[model samples]
Target: MLKIKHFFLVIFVLIFINCSKDEPVDSQETKPLVSAIDIGNSELPYIKIKTISSVLNEPKIAGEMEIYINQKRVLNSTIGIEYRGSTSYRISDKKSFGIETRDASGKGKDVSILGFPAEEDWILTGDVFQAPNTIFDRTLMYHYLGYELFRNMGNYSSRSKFVEVELNGVYIGIYVLMEKLKRGPDRINIESLIAADTDAAKITGGYILKIDKTSGSDVLGTHPLSYYDTNWDDDCRYTEFNSFRSNYDINRNRIAFPAYGAPYHSNKYLETYFVYDYPKAETINAAQKAYIKNYVNDFETALLTDNFSTNTRTYTNYIDRKSFIDFFIINELAGNIDGYRLSTYMHKARGGKLKMGPIWDLNIGYGTGGRVPVNDWIINYNNYVTNDAWMVPFWWKRLMEDPQFRSELKSRWTELRTNTLSTPKVLELTTNTSNYLTNNNAIIRNYTKWTGINYNYNNSVTELKTYLTNRLAWMDSKIASF
Candidate 1:
């Protein structure tokens, strides 16, 4: 009887020990233990993951990560979880894993895949814009948003991606890996083809020749004129020939046209491209001058013919008219400032064919800063008072000196303001954009902290009205002089 009882006790003790060994260890030990066990296993790579989700309790295990090993799904075993906020799993016998995080609402976030030798999967090339001596990870968020905005606007910009991994148990925003583009030929060079005059044949031949020369080549073409060329005005001449000649120096190329918030004159870099290879020989004689005058007239006429509907003809000449009208409509509908200057370069480049392009550099417009406080004020001052306004009266007085042009301009402005104010699509897109109230609040908070202005709606309206009225009065006097 004593021997049977001892045998039963020993069997019970062995079973209890086996059960304890099979049970999962505490959460704290799971991470290190799994990591240690998986080390040099040479079978499957272990992955440490931190997930952000709208649902799911802290340290919860994801039922099925739906992992793929080298694009093949891992079907046999379950993944383990650790830490309240992050999870870790030993993915033994797998080359890659595709991870998808799904919320309680049944929406699946995009799947991210990881494999052995992670760095081999991601590659970056070119002259990445980086601040020296700083880790690329430190400024990822800002650079990402900045580059994204610039690219979305259709400007020549760069590309970026992110890379990160964990060591122990900490979260980090890692390096922003970037690939650089070799500089391409300037758009100005292409524009020169328009002057060659042999209809489709000459134009096609010019482009084909250029492509052949540049095929598989990294070098930029030489400009037609040097900086010291006699055709340039004293203020416009490039003092340093070598520095000003390069296509990569945007300041020297200044291809960016005049837009709201930017200075009125052509950028210095742009001036080089504009003046280089300009047909100074053709313009030196009276016949050439006459030809240029005719060319300018034809350019203006073409713009009017192409862009203006029969009803919109009167306002066609002023480059920013549509942009200004759009701005006023948006501001009135949203009760906030979000409009900015549509660039003058669009009209200048297309000979008035195209109307608008992507809005750039909105840091200031919409009751933001500068001496002007309102859209109406900008229109009134630019139309009437400024020496360099694009409106008819300003252009007529300075360049055209024709009374008919001024009258036509006034008529156009009156018609446009009335039409734009009545458009519903204009009203809806402006008013329905999200976060206006929040953005306005943020703006007010920032201004109050910095400038101590009480930036309420009434105050904004009052200030805008006062500035516009004053500028209008000033414009009336200037028009009278014209």
Candidate 2:
């Protein structure tokens, strides 16, 4: 009887020990990156990004991060992240981020996060409310409007989706989650111009360039041909490069592509203004540079010829006329003072003509800026500046010289005014966007997180609506006279 009792006791003890054993795998696997929350469709989707303290302190450095969306774990990877923007970078406590999807080991998986287009790189743009020396464009819709008009113009433009981001368990404000421009199946859609594509025909197209503010980190390269001042009738101001100390003023535009080397440092003399944007300045070979340079020179030669309109040598031969017209209309319609001069982009396909734009960076368009009178034409660059460092290229003045260009532009404007650019359509977009943000509690949440920040949706919408109504009427009158 004693032995049997002892045996039962031993069996019970063994069972208890087995049950008490900890299952690390189960606990780790079941633990979520964040606690779940119910969200409505009207609200912008919420995202939680987990980060280590090391990364937050140095936002410039890339680190491993985990992402959760609307209560579901989505991505786990190491990413290269950096603070984005120039003026906005200096002003805002809320930081905009440029994120590279690759993990610390440089491994990445492609998946659509928060329903944005499938891309490895993404930008989380903070509202530029904190930017310095700027009249507050309270609408916060300039960028959204810029891209919308670009799309309605039937061009391939960056698709943006609104999102609320939570970093390391802290609620950050609303972000315009968007695609980072690059050569891809979807992004830039040009044939790959790898170093191996040395053939003249293979290399010509598929290049992207931009005119934007240059930073110390920019990979600069130069054309040996002297830089042109583009003063129209004034002889093209030539800057002969002697060395690094050449005090040549930076050109308004930068060379964004065909950079071959990826070196952070280079021995070559940097272009006075053009920063190599693609193919890493270290990667582009001598031949590639010559090709792009010659092509640009040839185009300019045709452009600058006094009899370009009357003669066979026309600027249309070198550019996509429709795209250029649409770009101009959007900029002019928005009254973007920075339109033609800054944040402008142009691209050349392997065999296609130079195309103007996928319009970008318009936080200060409309009546929101103090640079140029909101009601005045932005093309009148001389109205505000006496000796501007970045002058609008003579292209605008010359194009207007051609009767055909003007006719087409006027016709296009009229049609769009009835269709996509119609006032009713624009007002609807404004109303819908505002309601969506409000319904999602995004506006309230965003301003709340920023502490001391105030947002009035109705006022922003009213200003935007009023500006559009007047701008459209003014454009109709001006275009008709043009």
* Top candidate by TM-score: 2
- Model 1 residue 87 distance off true place after TM-score fit, in angstroms: 45
Candidate 1 per-residue lDDT over residues 1-482, each given as its tens digit: 99999999999977644422211223343332232121221212223343333212222334322221222333212222221100001111101122223333323332223322111111111111122221111111333333343343234333444332222333111223332221113221223333434443322211111100110101111222122122223222222221112121211122344322222243332221111122222223333223333433443444334432233443344344443333232222222222222111121232232222222222223333344444333433333323321221112112123344445444533454343322342233223321232232332332233234543434443443443344334433444453
Residue 345's lDDT in candidate 2: 75
Candidate 2 global CA lDDT score: 0.63
Expressed as tens digits, the lDDT of each residue in 1-482 for candidate 2 is 99999999999978744432221113244324442333444346555555434332123454544444444444555556666655455455676777766633455545455555666677777776553323245555677777877787788778888877777667776788788777777777777777666887788867776655542112221211112112121111211111111122222233453332222223112322333445545566666666766676566556666473464646677888888899898998888877876677777888899888878888777877667776677876655764554446556766777777888899999889888999899888878888887777777776655644555667778878999889888888889986
Q: RMSD of model 2, in Å?
A: 10.5
Query: What TM-score against the true fold does each predicted structure earn?
Result: 0.27, 0.77
